[model samples]
Target: MRKWGPLVAVCLGTFMLLLDVTIVIVALPDIAGELGASLTGLQWVIDVYALVLAALLLGAGAAADVLGRRRVYAAGTALFTLASVGCGLAPGTGALVAMRGVQGLGAAAMFATTLSLLGAAYRGRDRSFALGMWGAVSGAAAALGPVLGGVLTQGLGWEWIFFMNVPVGAVAIWLTLNAVAPDGARGTRRLDLAGAAAFALFAGATTYAAVRAGEEGWTSGRTLAVFGVAAVALVLFGRAERRAVDPLLDLSLLRRGAFVTVLVAGLAYNAAAFGVMPYVSVWLQTVLGLSPVRAGLALLPLAAVSFVVAAAGGRLLHGAQARFVLGGGLLLIGGGTLGQAVLDADSGWASLSAGLAVSGVGVGLVSPALGGAALASVPARHSGMAGGAVNTFRQLGFALGIAVFGTVATSRMTDVLHDGGAARELAGGGAAALRGTVPDEVLRTAFASGLDGALTAAGVLGLVGGLAALAWVRSPGPEAETEAKAESERDRGDGVPAVGAGAPASPGGA
Candidate 1:
């Protein structure tokens, strides 16, 4: 029990935080219906958690290093539990979105610490075994989220999805306090509070602009104003990074072509892959009349194939170059997303299976390789930054993708329907609610058209990512590689964390 206790505790927090990413998908209709949420509100509910999680991860990771990993992990679990209860009891769309953002804050803290906690707890073979187990558990989140959410929503109501966490979090908190080791010594790195704040402001502003653009025209005064804020925040973030003693993002890493390519790949891989699933969940329930369980099951092909392909890739392609693997995977993701763009009014849910499976291959191929690829591209001293940057971009990709795709979908639906006002309602899983007033056939056509647009947008992003990767990314020369390994060992001896000094999360997703 002593030996395995830390692994179990860390996994509990990891699974809950990641599961909430997609678990909210299957319950969107219920949430929209019960809360009377607008399309924008619905988008906020989904995107805010991801946005905050991405923004805070780097900052939170540094905090864990300073304040102690177990200490931060325990506080995060407690906060997440309380916030989950808040979400379950939220009285309206606004309250729910606010609580979900709090959930993200808690999630970021927990995520930032989990792997580091493992690194501190285990050694040698046990470290390898523990990390492998942790990765396996993390992979299960993307596969099981929708299915578990479905069972909870249909059988127990949507609230149980959040409510279910209370017991698990309580147990995790207990274990973290009792079983995990104390910090050995505090590090010298000071918190880059300026960098963290500026980055958060930038991310939040940009996402708000994307969401608002879907409502007010892109050229509208309100939309343009928010965009102006985003631009300013981005500039501030850059300045802060430049001035920091220990920056959240190291600017020097951006000079390397391989490192830059990996960052782009992280953004494209997540945005193109999992960003469109929430809308699919909507169409399944509101348009197709499938039960939540059935809707979740329909999405299972992608997750299942991803799991199998990832396991196979790890074994068979262990020695393969990351460029070919990641590039090829992204190409497959593009192909799969484009294939699904064929959906029409007459198409059924089964039309998504082949495309989902293809994208799954891409997801599996790219996910496990991300950290290794990032680590190899930069100097050993920058490895921790690379790891955290990969996750930041990946989550940022999801948030931005959701915002952009939602806009594309609503715009396309408005085009098809020729009624701008109805587009928002229809996009927010309101088809069943609007049925008697609007013709069912029209609703179906508009929804299909909107989905086609969103999928096409995601597909194009994927293709660009693939081609960029193929053209530019390269493995280091033998000399550089050897030097990096030596430096990495020295860093270890000096008690520096190899990856995620700020953070690296499990990369698997919807």
Candidate 2:
């Protein structure tokens, strides 16, 4: 108990953060119903959380290293808990979106420190065990969220999903304060708060552009204006980082082929793998008349397969080149998503089963390898920043993916129905509400076409990203050449066989 207590605390915090995200996926229709949220409102509900998380992750990690991991983790837990209360009590979409953005800030802080706290608490075999357990909890949290959310939403209310976080977070805080210890050392860099803000602006503006484009024409003045703002924010972010003494990210790393490849791979992997899921859930419940529980269950195969494959792949694929692994995995994801484009007007939930499972394999492969590849591609001094960068881009991908795909789904459906309002309603899973206004067969046909279009777009994105990663991913630095020379000299001196001669080195055999 003494040895494992800290792990429990970390697991609790991680579980809560991930669970909150997934539970909301299953509850979107319900939230839209109760709050009178439009399709755009629903998109923001998902996008804002990820946008904030991605924007603040780097700064949050730096704070944890400088301020003390235990303190930041505890404070983050408290903030997250309090924000969950606000979310639960929110009177409308505006209030709920605001609270959720706060929740993202807290999640970023808590998540940034979790592994560091564990590394400080354990060593050697215990470290591996702790990480494995952490992975298990994380996977279980994601797997359980939809089903548990369904039960709660069905039995209690959607608010219970947020309210449940109160007790869980309270316990996490108690454990953190009691069990976690101070770090052995601190990062010397100062915070890059300006960069964080600029990047946040960039992400927010980009999401707004995509969501707004769906309602107003893509070329509308408001959409174009926001896109211009996003581009400017991105430029300002780059400038700030280039000028900072200790930038949130060292912009110089972007010049490296390997590091940048890994970053894009991470982003594309997340977007293609998980972006369209909320819509899938909406379709199952709103169009097909599946209960929330059944809708949740429909998505379970992907999670289950990914978990199993990840567990087994960690050992089996260790020491392989990250380029091939990450690239191939992304290709598999693309292929799977492409396969799901088979959705026709007559298609059923079973039509998605094979594609989801295939994509799961890709998720399992890329999920672990992407981080390793990122860390391996950088100088030791920049490793922390690299980890934060990969994660930030990954979240950014999800945020953008949701908005872009929502636009695809909405636009295609609108083309079929020739009714923008009806398309938005259908996208939000309220198609049953429009039965009198639109024929059932017409609704199915338009939804099928829209979903198919979104899937094709995601698949093409993944394929393009995969091809780029494969082409550009080389060993990051001279580490491989240096290691080979040392091995050769050692063989002449002591005649020990070069055991890893052909592995072509990577992070944990990535």
TM-score of each: 0.95, 0.91
Each candidate's number of clashing pairs is 0, 2
lDDT of 1 by residue, 262-366 (tens): 889999988898788888889989998999999989888877887777666665776788788889989999999999998888888999999998998888888
1-510: candidate 2 lDDT, tens digit per residue: 668889999989988987776678888889999998888888888888888888887778777656777888899999999999999999999999999999999988887777667766776688667766665565445545777788788878889999999999999988887787655545465777888789889988988898888889789999999999999999999999998876887888898888888889878977897788778778878877777778777877777777786677767776787788788889988998998888777788888889888887777777767766775676644665777777778778888888899889988999989998999999987797889889998998898898898999999888888898789876545784465456435333222110011111111101
Model 1: weakest 10-residue lDDT segment is 501-510
Q: Model 2: clashing residue pairs?
A: 319-509, 322-510
Most accurate candidate by TM-score: 1
How far residue 91's Cα lies from its native spot in candidate 2, in Å, is 1.5
